[model samples]
Target chain A: MTAAQPATGHDHVVVAADVNGVSVTEPVPTRWTLAQFLRDRLGLTGTKVSCELQVCGACSVLVDGAPVSACTYLAADIDGRRVQTVEGLAARDQLHPLQRSFVEHFALQCGFCTPGFLMMAKALLDRNPDPTEDEVKEYLDGNICRCTGYEPIVAAVLDAAKRMRGQA
Target chain B: MVLPPFALHRPTTTAQALSLLAEDSVPYSGGTELLLAMRMGLIRPTALVDLKRIPEMQEIRTDRSRLLIGAGVSHDRLATDPLVEQHARLLAAAEREVGNARVRAQGSIGGNICFGEPRSDVATVLIALEAELGLANSAGERSVPAEEFFLGPYWTARDATELLTAISIPLPCAEGVYLKFQTVERPTVAVAAVRRPGGDYRVVVGAVGEVPVWADYPGVGEVDPVDLVGRTSPVSDLTGSERYKRHVTEVYIRRAAELLAESER
Candidate 1:
């Protein structure tokens, strides 16, 4: 009784979203999560869904510059909104400052949850270019990393913020 | 996808939304809680009336001493809205104590209160502040005091046909704070206390009872946190034993009261 099978009789919703600067409109199952739409429909596999529940930060994505748990956010509701996934962080040739800093500081081990961390960290830096260590720790209460004791992830975010502000 | 298939209804106005309501229809605010429950197959509503498009329910309007908080306001908005920060600072502080930045960005005050989750920090503060809830339905709009809104965990006075539109908080302008014991998104034991100069004293203890209990605060400068424990009847869950939760509830109450008292001087 716990595992939910899809409700059989349903129509679909048309979702038009600006994903990573590309605009697309597609008919989606009303129940499909934003994470699923990103990974399945658009084939943007960078957004990972580790714990489908919002508990894990593995599926964090930015909707209009605010970090949201994409696994729980419905694709149908994201209409007319801009969604930025980890795939959008980098240009064709250059890595985003956050991505470069993550690589420079070796922030990931399994590399599965890196996208979520990057996007969440991006929002944090956008608001406060220089955050205290405790502030960063508190802001990331929902985004969890099972590897590296989070020291390097914290260091990488600080470094990225410095690089973004041109203070590095 | 974890969520069961359903039709999505987007209505721009409250009356239009009310017209679309049915037994199997559920109102979607931020979809933070609704989507989570839907994914687990716990709730299978046939249709979801998305409330985000309703402009009337999205304003945080300040009229003199009272502030009308739209139910559609996200947790982050409640936490940082300038009017909330200036007028109902304690409620603002409580919003911050909710889930982290990510959760706050998507969770709405309406869902938080309408869902009537006993462990919700916002609910505790609202009860302590003597807040009133604005509920709309096919008939008309009515106001229910925050104290009378909750019946139990996951249960509220608003029927399926009714929608929670806004929350009105009387400007207590009191020195107040909400303190909680938590290891995750929900609090294990939370307490909200407010002390207004030459006005009133109130306290609410939660996460330990069926619904957060509003305790009778003793007069000015007199506080015994242990007194709240008896009123709450702390329930034992994964967080701790019943006795332990009761103890922590007392501790947090003490801390909250101390903060209130210190501000009075």
Candidate 2:
């Protein structure tokens, strides 16, 4: 098969991501990252992209319901896979417990890193609801929060876990 | 920034990928390392042949005596694999410590080994385990031991026409442990040591040299620190001075000895 030239037109790469309980297939660019496809192609820009490199975690999205760096993953790789971005986290008029806890605990100083932190925290708590302080730190080590110290962020995650489990 | 303009080729067979590579097109697996290199202008290829679609290149099965790991298996998969965890615990642990969860999920073992990055944590572990690399081309298939696969800093013994298909790690008679000493938030200096039954050992030190260095331990006698030190000529990079790396290598060797001693007990 002869290789073709790079074109700007949109080619159909089947992406079976669940966007807020809706399974959709879209035609995306061959080189489009999951972050770009979410924001530019699907117009779901709630998942922010700060450092395109995987360092800053600002573009964290749930691939198969696990928090992953969307900026680094190619959209084509997740073909026929389910993806859930921040926009898909909450129900229609009902906020997820982590979202509510972030607002209640003032976990955001600038709100730029909130989505990433929330996604990471959500994934952590989903897997381990009653995580220790050290476990929480280790699990969220990949996330970088430049706005506020991690004290409130950690507290909010813990508090959210308690709230979700009806503990306190 | 957008990825530079390049044609993408999804090759369904290893032969197809090797043919493209023979024509100077780059074969891509994870795209984590190659993408970074392309962005830095270190590698400027006009085409990228994606190898993820190849069925034979994604198998992680085991033979009678060896564990055959496909090149496309991600670090995340390796870390959580039952067979890999049972046979190569140190490798599974090191894979967990690779970059982060994201990189672990996206990066492949083949890409990690084939890239031949000097500072790679998995490369050192593979060398310590005495893994065999399987390479294929239009000519035929060849298996190169991991120790000889890495030639120098970011250099491998791979020919232009070859595509690394799988990595085979021989089941060892010992419990292995990998110890890495990294300065705070960077790559590690020394990586793994395989301590077998009857007190035989193979200590692998990476990031301190151009390629991972393997030293044989005769027996569990009084280990001379000097013997382990200065074995590898480390460079003074931004990570640390050559002197500091040598010192850390000794420290990790002692640490490995203690761990092995406890495991034996």
TM-score of chain A of 2: 0.88
Where does candidate 2 clash, by residue pair? none
Cα error, residue B138 of model 1, in Å, equals 1.1
How far residue B182's Cα lies from its native spot in candidate 1, in Å, is: 1.1
Query: Model 2: residues >4 Å from true position, as ranges?
Result: A1-17, A165-168, B183-186, B197-199
**Who wins the lDDT comparison?**
1
lDDT of 2 by residue, A1-168 (tens): 112322212333555556666776666666677878888888989888877767777888877766678777777656656777788778888988888988888888988898898888887877788888888877777788897558888888988888888853
lDDT tens readout by residue for model 2, B57-86: 878877987889999998988988998888
TM-score of chain A of each: 0.90, 0.88
Cα error, residue B169 of model 2, in Å, equals 0.9
Alpha-carbon lDDT of model 2: 0.77
Worst 10 residues of 1 chain B by lDDT: B215-224
Collision pairs in model 1 = none
Model 1 alpha-carbon drift over 4 Å, by segment: A1-10
